[model samples]
Target chain A: MPETKSQSFDESQSAPMHKALQREIQLARNIQMKLLNGEKPELPTGEVSGISIPARLIGGDYFDFYPLGDGRIRILIGDVMGKGIPAAMLMILTRGAFRSAAGAAQGPGQTLTMMNDAIYKDLRKLGSFVTIFCADWEPATGTFVYANAGHSMPIVVRSDVGTVTLPVLKGVMIGGLPGQIYKEKTSHIQRDDLVFLYTDGIVEAQNAQGEMFKLDRLSGILVEQSRQTAEAIQNAVVEKVNEFTKGLPQKDDITMVILKADGDQRGV
Target chain B: MFKYELIDEEATTVISFEGDLDIDATELMEEEIAPKLYDCSNIKIDFSKVQFVDSSGIGLLITLIHHLRERGIRVRIFHVSDEVRIVFEMLQLPDIMGADVLPEFEHS
Candidate 1:
């Protein structure tokens, strides 16, 4: 408890400044939500949707869908290290990097490489890292390619094979090293298959009994609801987690993005 | 939650930690380590009792490592448990820190 000049500043002397700080954080949250939730990218032959629920008033989980101009769409989701304000600040920094990288990179692997190169120094200097999963989808060709950076794999719910975690792509987390190269894998989706992407927050959410809603449980839920629309499946998974936690306070953010092959043609 | 004991062994300083090395507990370690570092050249961290660590904890360690390196202080880590090693290896701590912490790999 040694009083550093900033940490031990007089609280009473900065009442207005405190309020201003709170408002600024609120604005930051607003900006994050606006950017993450803006502009749904509809596939000509499929559908995609995403949502993020921060554990705190503001959180660090981020998800976005950017439609590529060439009949393909790019989706990105990530969890920054830590939570709340510090994590949120890094989340924005990651977002800027992702936006810039996605626009210029030719593939998901290249996007991660660019993003890591852009922010690795800063993140390592800050002593934190981010796990990210990025993928590109082409409805016309049924081609899906993805790359991961120490991220939890997405669930691939095949119409025939039930729900399975996406194959893990071997790559280190962003900021783990300099001059890192990321590789991607490609897969084809059937007409009724679904791909679910998420951050670790969802599976790590703990219940009052200290039991976690782990990966198996999440996969089970996806298996049961494989036929549902992207949004309905998303909400159902959220509902399941809510029931399991049963109103307990959580320490991590939860985020999910779902894509169903030929989903726009099917009604929710 | 964690506890630490600073034991001076000959010319080397050993900081043995028990319990979780986490973000919330970082300040506690910082309060102690910051003051004693200048008087020491070689530092050893004992993680035998550490049950968990998060990114912020790792970050704190990396920052401390950089600071020590800048000041010409050397650091070594030992007794890493499987739980902690998973994180250490995932972040490629061995390559980054220039340390030999993961001398042996154990799976639990």
Candidate 2:
């Protein structure tokens, strides 16, 4: 009788342990999904389409859109240093920080500064860093002010003209240093202009030949897809990237944000 | 990517990081240390060991700076390497993050 009781107790314990592990995995998946499908903020002027595709169930890439008051819109894109759950969690933190700071009436430069200060200590504790791009657009005046924090250069496409790569302002990766000041630059948005922001995952995407997708290819695609709507352009870019990889395993998360400045649709 | 080391001083905190300062590092920082930002006013970070960084890292830093500034805290940076220093110069981070390369340690 005593032997039977011991066996039963062991079985019960094992069952609960299994259930706990399953629950933890589920929770991790849920968090990753949330990061992938982040909350979308309404646009003050033109339509915006943002997409993030993680190489793994949990990825290190992130993009975010948030509306600022006074006809201003904030857009951000970032890449974490590593992969897996830790990277996903970092993406979440970055998204939250961008939203909170930009939402609190901070401009691109100030926002980057504040973010750097917020994470410097924690980053030291964990020995990690992040690259980011933050920009504020005023639809009313077609003015764009941005601060680059060690991210890729955003491409601007004009309906009449071809695509133009905006120059990156002087900035360092956040959390790597505190008190590193970031500069901001302003540009007048032309009519029917489209801004494209993306992560290295897109350019670094490899093919069977072990060749990277490269920026030239991305630029060509952007030029070809310039006529499409923001959402369509985003979809097309993702599709092209997938086709390029040809069902191969993705090594990193691919994320992109497309912003179109349409004069006629400014009210939207 | 983004990492840092914190040294508690009399009235200031010295933090340093190596490798890439990207999104993953940002999340680790937020989860592990964001709460402590409320306590310090003077903060310094060293980025001599960083190799590459991106926009997400910038966003995280800006947010942190804003948080500390709101509480009347002052932040500084030291020992930024040349390669990474170019990135900071291009983004004009010095204007925003109060960062400057350490002049004392010449890059080898």
Candidate 3:
């Protein structure tokens, strides 16, 4: 009798709590979207665009552009461990660390080192980690310097070469270990070459048949759309993923950042 | 969407994981598998049946190994499929979790 009474009482108490929770989650989604969709920096020699689609109402994927003056923009893309509200909170933490680190760090590698130093203890305490790729793109000089911390390598699509194979550069995921020094690599972005940075969700997105979209399919689309604008290419990839999944709900967050070198080189 | 089997061989316990090791497996790993393995002296993880692992899955795997290793337990992972192995290699799990933990497969 007591158990039945408790069940009835709990049913009465749960509805309002559930409604309030849903409302709060929606509000949180709004805040996250606003932060993620902040103004794109105006680049003179190339155009850059980014987008994120959470597996849930909110997600852990993050991308940001920080203009460092003189036509150079610091671009960062990261995938926090896990999904949903917990991951979203950590993503905000990651964004804060990057903003603070980018202000003083000279290059991508240094920024990563500072970020790791800032967040390693907290991440270890929480039993989590983040995979990130940071890069400084100077549009005026077409210099693309980047560093990776256990994130997927960006796919480069050159008009003449198709998919360009990059040298293997990897580091332990942020928070995996303390005192990590991420090494930097440099590549010149020739005119019309496209650099695609992404989270694993895109390649791992599964269809109803359980077939993944994989890197090969993504690379083919990038190569075919190499001539498109950054925004267009981003849209094309998203469209293809949607088509591939056929409305099956994704289990992980999908995110991508695109950088396309323009034909004319000038500082804005 | 993950399941596991435990086989006791002398003093060593071998655990084989099957299905996608993603967010949904968190509860099972934390509440069931981890608790069962904490007291073991030696453990071997079989990743041959594991087809996919996401960021969240990676976190779970690392946490499980770290906890076991902290207790001075010997852990080794073998029979990882090429796909799953690539993900582990990308994260450089060999370096962080001890190279001996995830050793190269020996062809017999």
Candidate 4:
């Protein structure tokens, strides 16, 4: 008999294989959920929270917070190419590279460079890539320094300035090239200002009519909910996307992180 | 959905694409592209009529490119419009496609 893809999933051949496959998928999902939703580190000058919702039983979107031990919080968020199993598996590979790079690298730019170097071969081998926005929130200085890897810029809600703006940062996506260096950008995070990071799935979410949620709607919600705490802002964005989607099938994984500056800045 | 045509030249193969390359079109894309993609030395993919490509569509492109390159097949992309260029830029397609991909640009 010639081998075929249908043979493994053929119901007539084996019931035990189906049960085994289901159990393994569930186990994989549990592992991914726990690793992705780890505790956010405490910050002296700001507050931060994040959430990830998978379109399938497992997703490719990823976000994590790590303390640099120097009054700064390192946060990384990204979207892996494709969805479901292939993407989820690469997400784990990316996670490992990020954690390893963040430890030895001095800044976000260097961290991305290190990560790209570590994972470029593997991503190329698998015919996939990841887009990451790596940032270090310097709470004492109220500065948000970030590096981009082909990910779209995150919205910055300036409460004191009363404006919503995107920070300037440009770089090729990770695994785009073997030895590409990413560019880092900076913004002064005023007290009460909010920095929002996310994957593309949020903005690309679609409605029943095929209209996408889009960046304009997300910006509006963030600016309107800027005064709220990090948790509230995150919830509001998710709610807005949900409302726009209206029970439409989710096309990809959604993940986001919001960092809100603490203390008072009545007169900026 | 995308409709592709495979034109066999004496030395090169041209796979021309027309239409959107969303998730729903991957299987169709695979069925069309796979047979022609094998054992070609020079491949040119024309994206002039391609409108949009989502992440899943990008996966197909990447996987195809990887396969082609492993066989040492030279690939060329031509007539990529501004909209499709954005998606290519996001995924950094030019890097894999090489620099001489008919002047595709990244939107600022």
Candidate 5:
């Protein structure tokens, strides 16, 4: 009779393996949550409110607002190419790169170009890309300068004209190619104007029948809820998406950043 | 919903993905596929069978792509459905991912 090889087993191994995995997963969740809640850099001239909802425990979406020395606010919203640990990791990289590049006094376009170059140079090392939107707001002058790197175009809600979707700032996704040039554009925000920055999660949310929440719905919501505070606007947007999904599991992270020019005529 | 299969064609590793690429599948992919990324030079992702992909899925792909690109490795995708293709095009990722649209196979 051929001797059968005994299978090795520790009765205690199963439980600890499961427990260790659970602990690791929990730790990851906590880290991601902390990154999401990281301090909102102080705005010297205006107020800023931002919210991010990961479709799950981890996500690829991110937003940030920081005050510049020249009395302008720097706002950034971006989506990494993938989700989960990979996306989360890339989000961290993009955030770091953007912050460093912006701190060097680079304008939106130049900052984006440098960021794109940095990401692209590391792309072969990281094997991913990101789409980003960076903007500078001069509270005193009510002038807004923005650059887009294949990210979603922000919606501007004017006091008199209602909701308006700005054109794409014209650029490809960061880390996709080398020497890509990002275009910067400028616009003036009148008193009481509202600027809404968001991730695709909001508009792409689906209903029971698989219908999209749609941009029109989002625009309508913005128009109706324009008077709400930044926090309220974030909450309202989440609520609308939740209602539309009707209890479906959120498929992606949802992030929104709202800035309202308080109609102050004082220029910085 | 997610399913994965490893196919060997002419020494190339083709991991075929099907169904929804969301949070659940994203985790599964990281667990099952991430380790293998370092082992192959020519990695082909078959998304023709994929139904839907959200930001999480895109994030996972980006991470994997970034890692592979760093190693001087390239990832190729094939069989993308119309919907997944649109998402890629919207994000302008085809050129970066080196994904090529293959001719649809017709059965006579």
Candidate 6:
């Protein structure tokens, strides 16, 4: 096979095109990181923090905090199906829906309902779905109200009780069906209690041996780190996950949010 | 990595999969697996050897099932292990993909 003029010409143009694409992907990853690590609401009585680590250059996992007018902070965490650039695009869409719905909705359940209505058609058309866990935390009153959209349940940790089991609540994932009304569940948050919300990526992370960092291991770590600050606990979990995975490349985005009641009240 | 064996018969098509289903299966699912099922009237997916399925896998699985159903193919899944079944239950796959498609099977 001999190289023709067309082949020579095509080879001449491929390098810069590849370089330009790489630059664009790097910029996209920076934008995603900034949005995901955006401002956290200043709570009067507790602390909240979140982090996201994409498995690829850019990822689909998302988490945000919106301060409500009534002193409660609206928290959203979700994992969009698939990964990389396509998932990252849908994550931005999900963030927009959550932000718009957070201000207008009265509770976590309503927020999810509105979000579903906003993005359901688009998701269906794309053949993708997102599992989300949304919650409204009132620092002064210690009221924790949350709703689920086919996402993992948040683990509640109390120093005296260990990992508190939450009652099961079910709802279809966004785009799973139309006209979905996600039901809400309420729980009391005492002072010093920590709520651990995460995507499946955390537990599903695998090591070189093909072993997963299961829920039991995560819960044990949480129980041991219950005495630390919200940020410390978050870091501890990440460190343990890194140790468990032993530097293996992850296949999914790892993300989590920590909300802890700090015991000083300014509003109810 | 994912691998599958397709067994097509006169009235039914059975596909057995082995290995963890994840993002790696995207191309194979769309280009290879789905095209094979287009002409089948009935399809059954065997999950006996599958041990893990992540979110990406779920997405591919959803697309496959919906694609088949939209074409009037009757699809059902059986032999899912308890661990993978728990993941499916958490995501409410039974409801989203039709409960009949994901029937109960005894865990060995």
Best by lDDT: 3
Clashing pairs in 6: none
Q: Is model 6 an incorrect, acceptable, medium or high docking prediction?
A: medium
Candidate 3 lDDT over residue span A68-109, tens digit each: 986799999999999999999999999999999999999999
What digit string (tens of lDDT, one per residue) describes model 4 on residues A1-268? 5456676558565778788888999999999999998887877767888999888889999998879998988899999988888889999999999999998988899999999999999887777788899998887788788898888778887864655666566687888778988778887887777788888788888798878788788887887888887887788888888888987888788999988887332322
- DockQ category of candidate 5: acceptable
Ranking by DockQ: 3, 6, 4, 1, 5, 2
For candidate 3, the lDDT comes to: 0.92
- Candidate 4 regions exceeding 4 Å error are A1-13, A160-167, A263-268, B7-14, B39-44, B69-74, B106-108
Best candidate according to DockQ: 3
Error at B104, model 5, angstroms:
16
Candidate 2 vs candidate 6: which has greater TM-score? Answer: 6
Which docking band does candidate 4 fall into?
A: medium
Q: How well does model 2 score by local distance difference test?
A: 0.73
Where does candidate 6 stray beyond 4 Å? Answer: A1-3, A263-268, B105-108
lDDT, candidate 2, A95-124, per-residue tens: 767766776646888888888887767765
| Per-residue error (Å), model 5, residue A249 | 1.4
Q: Model 5, range A1-268, lDDT digits (tens) per residue? A: 2233222344447789899978887788788778767776555454567888876668888887767877888888988766667778888888888878888856788888888877787754665667788999987678899998877888888766898766555567787679977778998876577788888888878788878897899998888877766667778888888888987976667888888777333321
lDDT of 1 by residue, B1-108 (tens): 677889999989998888756566667757777567766898888888986776667767777777777788877788889877866776667766674433454321
Question: Per-prediction interface RMSD?
Answer: 2.3, 7.0, 0.5, 2.0, 3.2, 0.8
The sequence of per-residue lDDT tens digits that candidate 6 reaches over residues A21-100 is 99999999999999999877787778998999998889999999999977899998999999999999999999999989
DockQ by candidate, in order:
0.38, 0.14, 0.87, 0.51, 0.31, 0.80
lDDT of 5 at A13: 72
What is the Å distance of residue A168 in model 1 from its true position?
Answer: 2.5
lDDT of each: 0.82, 0.73, 0.92, 0.81, 0.75, 0.90
**Residue B13 displacement (Å), model 4:** 5.1
